[model samples]
Target: MSLTEDAIEKIIGKFGRYQTWILVLICVGRIPTEMQLSNVVFIIPSVNYVCLDEGAFNATNYCPCKYPEYDTSTIVSSVTSTWNLICDRNQLASLAQSMLQVGILAGSLFYGHVSDRYGRKIAVLLSLLSEVVFVAISAVVPEFWIFMVCRFLIGTAVGGTMLCCYVMIIEISGKSFRPYLPGLIELPYSISYASLAVIAYFLRDWRHLQLATSLPWLFVLFYYWLIPESPRWLITTGKRQQAIDLLTYIAKKNNRPTENIESLVIKIEEQSLKENEQRYGTYLDLFKTSKIRVYTLIMALVWMCCSHTFFGINQYIGRLQGNLYLNVILSALILIPGLILVVIGSLYLKRKLSVIISFSVAAISLLVFIIIPSNMENATLAFAFIGQLGAYTSFVQVYLYCSEIFPTMVRNSAMGFASVFARFGGFIAPFVVNIGIEWASITIFSALAFCAALLCLMLPETKDTVLLNTVAQTEKNKVVVNQEST
Candidate 1:
């Protein structure tokens, strides 16, 4: 074990009731974010639409409306029916979905910096509060543009909540619990996502569904009282007393002795002071070295592909030939096993190999669907679900892999940059789906997954490896490893 790990053991012990309570709180914070993300599945259902000018499309026997007014009686009410966003205006549905990703891109960077400069608790509370307001406003928006803007804002807030809370939980948890933490946290997302189908099925109206998802977030505001500021971050920022108090509370809650707490505090304070002497690296440092630069580029592409294909499949849920509710729920459930596999892989196998194989499996599953005969609908559906499983698993692996690749100082910045690219992919996904040819979009998605798999080949395995603290340390360790191998 490293010094920090050993120190943490003396302070908090391994995973305990205190750590479990913190994890539960963190997981609760993510529930609304997932609900908002999947709520679009219900809000944008296809309706019976007709062109505004019926005369514009005149055939000898029949005429099709170019801008069809929706036949609302036969279908559930949605953004399409409420705003006449069908036919010529149908692109707005995709725009609304994509808008959230754009907000996430900007929000992650902004909130990540805020968490670093201010504190995790502040960032998380503010984010949750903002998410509630934006989502509530979105539910009652008078215009499509306003709705899109609100979604963007909500996306931004969700980004802050996700990053701040997630990082804080990881920072505060014991080392023995680290490997299992991410996958376990992801369970809340899957559960929330699956619940969207049930809620949407009952709500039916877009506004009602929005209200249902948005209102629940209001309760999350109470987290300010329930969760505390991260002790690690406090120590790093030179808030020694605050860090000591928080750690002491954790130790007490875990039923550990507090008599030795002073010594542990002194050690942490000394280490923090010593580390503060070193220069912090910027995001640009990720590219200063050839090895890290290549890794960064490859990982960025991987992030982009994952976000692109993931959202691509999600937004196209309406196109699937079945009950929309069933499709969405089943799709979410399909990812549960994938999430479990990710935990297993991260715990047992090489990280790089796990990522590559998952990507490969996903790519093949997706590509094979194109060749499946149209008559074999069940077979095609089965393959698509299999593809979703692999894709989501790969997505989780990439997130874990990226966390390990970048060192502490600029890790969040590097992640923020990669997320921007992922949002770029999401920004393009809505348009990609509307390419008028479903197969062509599938071809592009499959190609990107294949490329991601190849890129994963070039990354070093990070499982069971010590996390480097700085760019200088990483570079020095690389040299030492090279010299020893030679």
Candidate 2:
């Protein structure tokens, strides 16, 4: 009877809490798909890139490399001056993407600290709002150098979006809804990504594409009304008053009543002092202890696996070596099944098995491409397309696992480390796909698949385990979250 009671409590526990699917949507909802497609123009030096020139990277963040100073005077003429440099022009565009990733890394890593210290509302709102500004600035950079800076800044903002939203959704939903919520986030993100391709198909010019993608950020201002502060964080941070108030708000929004809310909600069970220590927002902390170190390391590899194939397919059009339209359609095609598989898995399969199975399938699918050979009629193209379906499933699992494995306080930070790895893969994507595959596409896909398969071994099963409360809690049972209004 107690077992049944616990299960009931768990369901009740999840009511109105941040569900995983909603979190997934928030994370990927506004990805600048159009910007990436349009920005492809920047790779061609002869195109003569022109826009506002603002310094890239740490023109704001606490890093270095601020140079060339934001100057608009000769932006057009200066960029045109490099007409002869067209052969090597991809360096700048790739560099811009890399810089943007730096910001993403920063945002992902540090925003948790901010969210932990302040509130998720402030953290998420500030991050998205900043992206809005950066996106616009990226659209209007007067000089080539300034554009790169804005891109990096924009990356930083979007980086925070994924992790923060992940946490937010988990904190809001009921237990039964949590896993599904995480994958649900992918739907909107996929839509946004494909839309970029669709819009780029029409806009053509980088500036216009930039405008098309970045302007939507203005819509984020609506978050001020649509979103709420994370109730879990509020509860953990000793803001019971705010937590309760937020709960009331969610109940109201969901059409559920607060008349019996107190009885309906079961407070979480808080931890003891040593277990109570919050996450230290630093690089050392990621490697501070054994369990965290293991999770962090495995997550890095997982990031590599996810990013390698993810961006690999996205960056290399030649790999498809097929119809451009067909390649894109295939790329977009994977999202549907990907989301479907995630839903099916989360509802039916155990978490670990689902993840391993998905990863294994993707790896094998990738390997199949090598044996099938690109020369065969539609072999490589069809394989690449199918493999991406596996990649999408694997992708959602990473987010689900990461969110469940880290303490709520450091969720953003740990995800940040993972993001850095993923971003690094994203940064290297064009080069690996464009250059490496020139020699052999099969070899590239084969290596990536095998690596993913191997990395899946290091991660322990996070499903059904209590969600992590601290680095020390990884190998043991789930870290117990407090249920009371301390």
TM per prediction: 0.90, 0.79
Q: Write the per-residue lDDT of candidate 2 for residues 159-183, one digit (tens) a residue.
A: 7776676666665655555567645
Candidate 2 lDDT score relative to the true structure: 0.59
Local accuracy by lDDT, each model: 0.74, 0.59
| Residue lDDT tens for model 1, 292-320 | 68777888898899888777777776577
Candidate 1 regions exceeding 4 Å error are 1-6, 56-67, 73-75, 259-262, 265-295, 466-468, 479-486
In candidate 1, how many Å is residue 181 off?
A: 1.7
Worst 10 residues of 1 by lDDT: 58-67
lDDT of 1 at 276: 44
Candidate 2 lDDT for residue 321: 55
